[model samples]
Target chain A: MNIEIKDLRFTYPTGLEALKGISLSVNAGEQVAIVGQNGAGKTTLVRHFNGLLRPSAGSVWIGDWDTSKYSVAKLASRVGYVFQNPDEQLFSRDVLTEVAFGPKNLGYEKDKVDALVKRALSLTELNDQTETNPYDLSPTWRKMVALASIIAMDTPIVIFDEPTTGQDAVNVARIANVIAELKKEGKTVITITHDIDFCAENFERVIALSKGEVLLDGPAREVLGQEEILAQTYVDPPQLTRLGKMLGLKATVINQEEFLNALK
Target chain B: MAFVNFQNVTYKYPLTKTPVLKNINLQVNEGEFIAVMGPNGAGKSTLCYALAGFVPHFFKGEISGEIEVDGKKSSESTLDEWVLNVGLAFQNPFNQISGAKYTVFEEIAFGLENIGVPRNEMKDRVDEAMALTGIRDLADRSPYSLSGGQQQRVALTSILVMRPRLLVLDEPTSQMDPIGTREVFGVVRKMAEEGMTVVMVEHKVEWIAHFADRVIALNEGQVLMEGKPNEVLTADLLPEKGFGISRYTSVARQAQQQGLWKQKQLPVTLFEAAEGFTSKGGGGSN
Candidate 1:
């Protein structure tokens, strides 16, 4: 589903104004990454997408449905939120049960739920660990279980929070592949991440936030190219981008192939 | 003599069949900054716990080895006494915050209080620590109210205020943004420069390369490799052994295969990679 966020402003109960009238839109099936330093309001902005947080001064529309009008549970049918810390959400005894929880809570038929859970488990490469306790797995694998739990919901829009935070290279590749699969299914995928390289590789569009304001927003290459502006948010451009700049290359580079091409 | 020594160290939790750390032997000189790296379950955290005197003492684990820090044997000293010489700040700063404190200032001073530092000296030490970590402004804020990155700074500052001879950090910036990461590393580097030995477990290879004097790679609780940051990080076996090498290093490795990069040594940081690629070199398309 498409997302339309207009002039959004949010303030915590302690009177911290997190979002300072930010605005953006995302088309259906578009993969978008929201990036900024810690406490840059990336989490605050995306929480509005699934009705977890309401706009104090503006509006967020997921398709035609206004976020303010729906409860988080109501929005769950359309927006699947995978929290940053898996320990915060995981409650099931085993991986299969954890993966099935979302769909089951949404009241899907048992057969459908089973299929969805199995599909998610396989996608996350957790099929062998279906009977294993999630708590017994490593934190990296727990993160995958969390992702699989949300993907089982099969929502039109999925939001992942810092998917690569503590993951290794292999796990990171798994997460990237999951996003690619979601995009193939015409699902809108939005992620809040600190891994700029991962963002540069997987996402086409990027929205950079600074103090709850939209500091920069555009295709990943264009937005990441603004190194100085990004540095203001305490973000470095993708490694290849920085490498290209440091090399004084004529073209903007965001990946290895481009860096090699620039060398030629 | 080494400032920190671990000889034939092997440890297992209460019920675990396999030791988390296996036959690990390492030595760190005084004031040397060392970074440890490994995949999940590689015993990186276990190593940190062992150094910080938490393994056999706190966890009640079966540990067999000799661990010595600053002339004091870990097996011989009490946890309280060991902590006075070696301070540890780990991942998940939220858990590190003492729940009894209201303000960040009080939270930092709590450590000194528990260790029985005089009241008058506590204030100066806390002030100096906060300044060193750049958290002076957060002194009055509630420790619980701060963000993860801010809380991490508080945790680090709390440990740093103790002025322990050796500091052990476990992914102190795992939850931090890039800026927070840099700031924390700055404090760590400064501490090492000021003659405080440090052993850190971290995944951010670039930052480790920038600050660490030595790098130790661990796999399945064994020391896989140890050397200069560039040497170990750019080692060909790192990826195969499930170590997380920097992206720049990997990219340069790929370029080498295509005859696009001429450097004999792969770059671990962006600046090094840039300099190598841009330098007037041989055996490359450029």
Candidate 2:
């Protein structure tokens, strides 16, 4: 589903203006990454999609549904948000139950829920830990459980908030593969990430928010290559991109393959 | 004998089939900044806890071996005493906050207050620590009101204010933005230079390569390898062992096969990769 925001403005109860008047649209099946420093309103902005937070002076539309009109639980079928901290969203007793909870909450048939859970388990590489308690697992594995739960939801739009944070290299690769799978399935994936390399690799479109304003929004290559502008939001281009610029390559390289291709 | 030593160290939690940390022998010198790398469940955090006196003292585990730092054995020192010399900032910064304090400044000074530091000295130290981590602007903000990156900084500042002899950080910058991360590395690197021994578990090899004096690769509760960052980070065995090699190093490895990279040693950071890729008889692209 497409996400449309018009002049989004948000203010905390504490009188902090988290997001200023900003507007953007994410098309259906578009893999977009939002990059910015802390307190730049990245999280505050995305929270509006699933109705976790309401805009003080704007509108957020999840396709045809007005976000403000829908409760967070009601929006679950449309937008699956995997919180930054698994501990915050996870409460299931076992891996199987946790992964199955989302689909069940959306009132899917038991068979469909089971199938989705199985797919999510396999995709997140948590198959063996189905019976194990998520809290008993290491933090990294717990993150996978959180991911599987959201994936099992099978929403049209999936949001990952710093999915790569605290993940090891292998886990990171697994997360990237999950994103690739989501893209292949033609699902809309929106991620808020600080790992620029991961963002550049897995996301095609990039949106940079700087203190409640849209700093840059474009293709990953174009958006990420603007070192100075990205720096304003406390982001650096992927390592390969910076290296490409430093080497005076003909074009910017955002990933390893592009770097190698540029080298040749 | 080294300043920090782990000799035949083996540890298991209260409930577990196998030991999380197998027999491990490692040593670190004074002021040395050692970066530890490994995949999930590699016992990297266990090692950090062992060094910080949490393995046996707090976690209530079965431990067989010695962890010595600054000539004081971990077994002999209580957690309270151990924390004085060793300050640890784990991956989850949320757990580090002392909810007793409201503002970031007061939260950072919580440790000092605990140890009876003079109020004036406590303020100065907290200020200095916040300045080091580039969180001075967050002084008045409620500790709970900050972002993840800001909370991580506050957690780190809390630890830094104590001025521990051995600093243990587990993915301290995991929640930080690029700028916050860079500033953290800078602060930790400077602390290491000032004779503070550091053992950090981190996945950011690029930053580790730039600042660490040594790197230790861990797997299945054992030290897989330990050497200079370039050697350990670029080792071919790292990937097979479930460790993530830097993108530059992996690209270089592939380029070497296709005759696009020329350096005999693989690059771990972008600068080295750029040099090797652009040197004479290097990449024919640029």
Candidate 3:
């Protein structure tokens, strides 16, 4: 299963162009990250994947399902989108009910919905919070509830919009692990983020958008290695990458472990 | 007098019988840049609200001890008056913006105009605020149309136009990218340099460690530690206090363990760390 986008162009109702001629594809089970600065059309491009927004020009095809013709409800079964703010998406009284909302709306039986909710809660490490109110939990735990809601839907392609925003190191590492586990389960993962270190360490391919155009798209290591290109796009390279370049190192080092080994 | 003072203060939410803040004592000198850091539920936000006179003024709470801002007791001051003297930007930008029909210029000018500043003075102050926040070109744009980062700048500019003596920002850059974060910090640094005090509750240690003059760490609704940035951000103290130490600090500590660099003080910024490593004549790929 592959996702293909060709010559995509999206204009808001106010006649502002958000995405201009975006074209790309994600092979099945590949983890890809779309990175860009603020107002760079990264969110506009991903919202089109799940039929939330229709392109004024061009088309989006998720394994032969034309996104332009599909409704959000129809496409949601194939692609799950986790929004940036979990408060906007999670509204149920408890974590369990929130996770079960999607499966129940999709017409799953009670037993199946219960099992799916359980699986999602366990996968997101929120099983203990199943009985707790989402509003009472911390921001990180609320985010996990949002992820569990999507995972219960069992969409093969999961699109996360800035999953690590405002998260501390422990939560960020947990999210990275969740993405890695999703990849291991043969699910396609697409993330739109501004955390360059998260992109460099976890994603295999990085697609950078700047001013409604694709600036760079390739292997994450190679794309992140180009400090000049990143700076031109108004994106800061990871601190490790900057230190590596300043020291005249040959390869890009993203994490402290790699940076320390490089020094040795 | 110090701009802000808290002496052995304690507070508890109405619903919870337990105090959220316990025996807190701190002072903020005028024109200083202070960063407050802690894990979730650490009473950081509670401290900001308390300073802004929101604890007993807005929320029902039990309080003890004293808090004075600019030499006035918080209990005696009204919210409106204290809000003007000490502007606060919330963690979520969407909650702070007001007047749906207002443009960026009008939003920034609203506060000054409300205070009965002269018409001509309003324009100058608004323009100065916009320029300081790097949002001068966005004056004509609608506040709702801006991105998260741009909206945050608009919020800051709106407060800046009021010329508050102290600015309290609760996680202003939490939702921004690295570039956007730098832009927000740049404005903060400029404000502090121009003799305005800034108190920010932040989680991104690495980004602010280079800029902050002081660090105040909180845990479980109490002050865990407080000192200069270098004095607080260390291996022995940060992890135990539940504060996220910068990756650079972690790496520098490991390098010390491996006998690579032997500086007594840890470098907080990328530039400083690079210079420290290079000056020692050790561990750089040629």
Candidate 4:
């Protein structure tokens, strides 16, 4: 599942033009991360891919299917969205049930749903809490349950909204591993996040959005190396990148390995 | 007595089997800025509520232990009276917004109104608070129309306008961008400098390292470690206990294992990490 948008524009019912004319494309099985300040039209753009919001102008094509012709439910089978707030979407009593709900809703067979739910739960390290009430778990665990719920859908495209927010380092590592697993399975992963470090390490492509426009879109190193543009969007480069800059390293370094290698 | 003291404090929510906070003993001095760090369900937020007099007062929980703030006992004072000295701003800015008010300025003044602040004085205080948080231009905008970061600033300004002696913030910048986070931190730093005590719960280890006077690592409702920011944040056992240590510290530790880093102390901030890695006998430029 590829996503293509051309001259996309959106206006809320309150007369707020959230997204100006914008254009972008995501290749199938590609991992991309969208970053910007709060209310910078990142959410407005992603909502179009899943048909949650109709484009006021222009067109969004999900693998040649124009989003305008499809309802949100119709798009759900192709695109799975894990909301930023897990509480908003979590309605089931236990973890296993919550994970099973998505596949069941998509008309999967009982055995298939059971298999997918087990796989997702194991991947997210939530297998131990399968029978536990989701609300009884900590917010971090609840976030994992939410991710497992979406993963069980087995969509080719998965979209995560600020998945690392409010998570500790360990939980953040877990989310990154999940994304890696999703990519390994040949699924396209798109994340809108404030965690620049996570984005630097995991994503191949980084899109910086500012005020309903694409500020920069390129490889992770190139896009994140432009600190001035990122400053305009209120994003700082990853810690290692900043460290590399401070050390007068000739190249941009994103993680500890690169930082040490650059030092050598 | 210290400005704030918690003596063998433990609390459990209504009908809960286990206590969320267990035998937590701590103390804070006046005008000191303390940052509390912990994993989820570690009782950091409960500690904030105890400081702000909401744990037992608002929630009506089973609390055993003594909490003192500025010579007042938490269990003895009414919630209405306790809030006058200790103001709290939490994670969700939307939940903190007072829907009764039309504009940001009026929304900030709503707190003062509830506590019966005089009309003339309320206007002056509200303006001052707005100026402090850099939200003066948002005075006339509807509180509901502002962005999440902007609304968080307004929520903070509402509490600051009350002129509380102590401010308790729980991940107040989670919804903010880098610039917004810095803006809120700048305001909080200024308040601490001006003799207002503060206890903030945050996950951004880098920011906390720069601003906090002390760091407390909480785990499973207990204080796992407490001391200067540098000592607690760079502790070897932080990661094992599920505390969110700085990435710089982790990276430096890894480099040390590879025989690349020579610093005696691991770095918690980017500046420190860079200096340690670039200084004499260190890795880079060797």
Best by TM-score: 2
Q: For model 3, state the Cα shift of residue A132 in Å.
A: 3.1
lDDT of 3 at B52: 73
TM-score of each: 0.96, 0.98, 0.95, 0.95
* Per-candidate chain B TM: 0.97, 0.98, 0.92, 0.97
lDDT of 2 by residue, B63-161 (tens): 998889889888888999889899999789888897888798889989999999998888888888888888888898898888898899899889999
Task: Report every candidate's CA lDDT.
Answer: 0.90, 0.91, 0.84, 0.90
**Model 1, B19-136: lDDT tens per residue?**
9999999999999999999888899888999999999899987989899998789999999889889999976687688899999999999999997899999999999999988889
Query: Cα miss at A226, model 1 (Å)?
Result: 0.7
Runs of candidate 1 with Cα error greater than 4 angstroms are: B282-286
Highest lDDT among the candidates is held by which one?
A: 2
lDDT of 3 by residue, A133-243 (tens): 998787778888998899899888999999987676667777898898889999999998888877878998998888899999998878888777877667777778788
Clashing pairs in 4: none
Tens-place lDDT digits, model 2, residues A88-196: 9889889998898889989999999999999999999988999999999998888889999999999999999999998878889999999999999999999999999
Report the poorest 10 consecutive residues by lDDT, candidate 4 chain B: B277-286
Mark the 10 consecutive residues where model 2 chain A has the least summed lDDT: A255-264
lDDT tens digits, residue span A1-264, model 4: 789999999988767788999999899999999999977988778888899899999999998789999989889899999987788789999998899999999998999999999999999999899899999887789899999999999999999988988888778889999999999999999999888998999999999999888999999999999988899999999988988888888999888788877777
The DockQ of predicted model 4 stands at 0.60
For model 1 chain A, give the 10-residue run with minimal summed lDDT: A243-252
Candidate 1 lDDT: 0.90
Sorting all predicted structures by DockQ, with the top scorer first, yields 2, 3, 4, 1
Model 4, position B58, has a per-residue lDDT of 87
Top candidate on DockQ is 2
